[model samples]
Target: MNAQAFPPIPFLDLKAQQARLPGLKARLDAVLAHGQYILGPEVHELEAKLAGFCGAAHCVSVSSGTDALQIALMAEGIGRGDAVFLPAFTYTATAEVPLLLGATPVFVDVDPRTFQMDLASLEARIATVKKAGALRPRAIIGVDLFGQPADWAGIATIAAREGLFTLDDCAQSFGAAQGGVRLGKAADATATSFFPSKPLGAYGDGGALFTQSAERAALYRSLRTHGEGTTRYEVLRTGMNGRLDTMQAAVLLAKLEVFEAELARREEIARIYDAALKDVLAVPARMPGSQSAWAVYCVTLPDEATREAAKAALAAASIGHAVYYPRALHQQPAYQPSHDGAALPVAESLGARVLALPIHPDLSDEQAQRVAATLIQALGG
Candidate 1:
C-alpha cells in the first residue's frame, strides 16, 4: 500500500466519537431550558444511575477526577502523618491527592506485565514503613491502570488484615470488573473520571465517588461542598469546592444510553490488536476473572531502543502512538523526594518499553488492523 493512500490514524479520534453527540445535545438543550446548571435534577439522576450501575449504595458527583480522590480521602479522615500506599506506575493524581491532604504517598512497584500494582511489593513497602515508625498506614489507593482492574480481592484481604482503608482509583477502569464484581464494589470507596476520553465520559470535567456505606457517602457529599452539615452557610468542617456541573451530568446521561455498546466495541478492538500483535510484542494480559474497559491497547517492545524505533516507524507510516507514562511517578521530580531512595524496577523498566496504540470505542476495524500491521512491521515481526 502506498503511504499517500492511507492517512494518519489518530491516537484517539474524538471527532469520530462526535458522531455520537446528537443525543447528548438534546439532553443539554433540556438542561438549558430548566436553567439549573449548578446541581440540577440531572445531577441527582446521573448519580442514582451511576450508583446503581456500579452496584454501590451512593454516588457523589465531583468537579474532576482529582477532586473525587481528594473528597474520598478527606471523608475517610486521611491527613497529616498518614501514609497512602499507591503504585508508582500510575498517573500523578493518584499520589498528588495524598500529598495535598498533608499525607505521605508511599510508592510501590507494579507487575511488569500487567502494569497493575504488585501485591507483594505493596506488602513489602507496608512492612518497611511500619518498621520505620515514621507514619501510620492509613489507606491503599489501588489504581486500575490502563483500564484493567487491580487485584482487588487480594488487596482487600490485605487491607482488612492490616486495618487500612482502601480506595479504588477507577478513573481509567469505570466499566471494568473482576469475578462478577465491578470496580466500585471492589474497594471501600471507588472514584471514577468522566474526562472526555473515559469509557463513560461527559462533555467536560466530571467525576463521581461510590461507596456502600451510607454514612461514608453522606460525609463525602458534605465534604464535596465545604463540609456543610445543615446548609451551605453552616460549615461543619473544612472542605473544597468540588461539585460536578449539571450540564456535564446531562451529557453523561445521554452517553450512558450506549455505554455498554461502546464498551463491547472497545473489547473487540483490543482483541483484534492482540491477535495481530501477540506473536511479535508483549500484549496486555487480562487476568483470570477480570474484564478491562479497554481504555488503551498498550504493548511492550523488546527494549527501550526497540520501543523508540517502533514509535519512529509508526510516525513515519502516519500511524499514531503514545507513551502513557514515559516516566514512572517515583522518578518524577515531585515524588522523588518522598520515595526515600526506594526503587521500583518494574515500573521504571516498563515506563521505557510500554507504548499506547491508537484505541477508542469509535476506532474503525480497518484502522485497528492497519495500526496492528504497522506496529508488527515496525517491530520487525
Candidate 2:
C-alpha cells in the first residue's frame, strides 16, 4: 500500500470552517472600515448575540478565555487565603486562574464515566478544606470538560450547602446543555472561550463572560477596561487590560451565524464514531438529559501502553490524535507545592488511558469510519 494513500485529517479544521462561513470577510471588512479596533460596535453586537443565544442577561466580551475566568473570579473578590475547588482532569486554565489570584486550587477527582467534576469528590473536598482551617472555601469552579455539561444541578446543591459561589468554566461547552437548558446561565457566572479551535471560534483569541446579575456584569465591564468607572481617566479599581479587539469580535459574529449547523454536524460525526467503535472500546458515556458540544471524541484503552500503540497507529493512518491533559493538574511541577498530596485515582487513570480522536464539523462520515477502523485494528479487536 502506498503511504500517500492515507488522507490527511486535521484535528481542528479551521480552514474548512472559514470556507463555510462566507460572511467572515464582510464582517472583518466592516471592522477595518470603522477603524475602531478596540471595543467597537462589533464587540457590543457579538456580546448581545452571545447573551441572547444562551439566555444570559449580560455578556461581557474579553480578550481570551483565561481572561474570562479571571474576570469572573475578580468580580467575586476571591483572592488570597481562599480555596477554589475544581477537577484535576481538565485543562490547566481552570486550576491556573485560582492560583494566579493568590488563592489555592483544591484538585478534586473526576467521575470515571462522565469525566466531569465528581460532585461527591467536590463535597468531600469542601468538608476537608473547612476542617483543615488553612483556607476559606469560597467558590466551586465547576468545569464542563470536553464539551460536556458538569452536573450543574448537583453542583448547585453542593455549593449552596457549603456557601460557595459557582462559576461554570464553560470553555469547551458553550453550546452544550443540561436538561435542555443552555450552559451560560447554569452557574452564577459562566465563562466561555472563542479560541480558534473552539466550536464558535474567532479568527484569533476571544472570550465572553455571561451573568444574570446586573451588578456583576457592570463590575466585569469595568474590570476588563482598566477599572474605569464613569470615564476612562477615572479609575474605579485595579484591573487588567482584558478588552476583546474588534476584528476577533467581527470574526466570531460571522461564525456564530453558522454555529448551530456546525454543532449538528459534529453531533452526526460523533454518532458515526460511536456506532463504529463502541463495542470495541470504552466509548464516551452519554449523560442523561444532556447534550454535548462534541469538542473531542475520546476513548480509553486498557492502559498507557495500549494508548501509545493506538496513537502510533493513528499517526500511521494520517489521522490526528491527542491526549488531553496528559497529567492531572495537581501532578504538574508548579502545583506540587499547593496540592496536599491528595489521591485522585480516576484523574490519574484518565490521564494515562484517554486518547482524543479527530472530531470537528469538517470530518466526513467516511473519514470518521476510517478513523474507527484504524483504531479497531490497532486494538486487535
Candidate 3:
C-alpha cells in the first residue's frame, strides 16, 4: 500500500486513552466534589499506587520532574562547589536541576548503541573532577533516556567507589525495569515525570521521587511542603512549594487503571517498528535483561544530511515526527559557558541524526506500518 492511503497519525492520542478510561469522568468529579484541590487524599492515593507499582519503599509526589530532582539533591546537601555528573544526551531538566541548585554539571558522553551514559566516560569524568580539586565530586545522575533503563549496576559500582550519591533520572522510564526489577529501587534516589506524554502521565504537570530509605522519604515530604517540622508552622529548613495538585493526582489514578495495558500496547507498537525499520535505519537498542516503557521510539539516520532529507519526506507525507533534542546539553547555549571543553562525539552525533516517530498505545497496526514504509521510502530504500 502507498503512504497516501493512510490517514494522518497523531504523535500522541490522549483523547483515545481518555475514551478507554471508563472512570476518568468519575475521578475528575470526585476531585471537584471533595473541594480539596491542593494536597488532598487523591494525591496520597496516587503516590502509594505509584510506589507500589515500581516496588519502591516510598514515593513522594511533587509538582514536576524538575522539582523531584531539586528536592532529591536538596536532601543530599548538594550546592555550590559540588560537581554533579550526568549524560550529555538526555533532556535539559537533568542538567538544569544541578545548575539551578548552584552546582556544576559535568557532562559525560553516552554509548552509541544504547544512547545511555557511558560508564567509562562517567568514570573518566569523575576522575577529571576529582583531579581538578576545585569542585567536590558530589553526585551522579544516570538518566533513563528514551524510556530505557541506564546501566544502574555499573553506575552503582562507580558511585560506590567514588563515594558519590546516585540519582536515577527516571523521568522517561518509570514503568521500565532493570534485571527483572523495576527502576525505582535501582539507585539511591529516583525521580520521574508525569507529563501528559509520558507512559504513566497525569492530566497536567506532576512528578514523583522513589526511594528505599524512610529517612530520605521523610525529608522529601518535608522539602516538598516548605520544610515543615513536627507542626506545619514550625519551619525546619528552607524548601519549596512543590506539592502535586489533587486534580492531577485524580487524573493519574484514573489513568493508572489502564497503565499496564497501555504499556503492553506501546511494547507491541515498538516491536512492530523494530521488525519493519531495523533493516533500513538504526533502531533503539534495549538494555540487557530489561523492558522499556517505550515512551519515544526514535531512529538514527546515517548523518545530518540524511536526517534533514528524512524530516522533509516525513513532513511531505504528513507523518508525525520530531527531533527529541537538536543539541546536546554541552552544545546548548545556556550550558555552553559552563561546559568543560570536552568532545562528546557520540552524544553530539545522536543529537544531530536522531528522529522520533509516533509510538503510543493508541497507534494502530496500519498506522505503524505506514510510518515504517514512509520512513524507509524517505531514506531512499
- Per-model TM-score on C-alpha atoms: 0.98, 0.99, 0.98
Over 190-248, each residue of candidate 2 has an lDDT whose tens digit, in order, gives 99999887888877888999999999999999999999999989998999999999999
lDDT of each: 0.89, 0.90, 0.92
* Residue pairs in clash, model 3: none
In the range 284-320, model 1's lDDT, one tens digit per residue, is 9986798899887889887899999888888888887
Error of 1 at 114 (Å): 0.7
Model 3 RMSD in Å is: 1.0
Compute the lDDT for candidate 2.
Answer: 0.90
Pairs with steric clashes in candidate 2? none
lDDT tens digits, residues 210-280, model 3?
Answer: 99999999999999999998899999999999999999999999999988888889999999999999899
By how many angstroms RMSD does model 1 differ from the true structure?
Answer: 1.0
lDDT of candidate 2 at residue 290, scale 0 to 100: 92
Worst 10 residues of 3 by lDDT: 1-10
lDDT score of model 3? Answer: 0.92
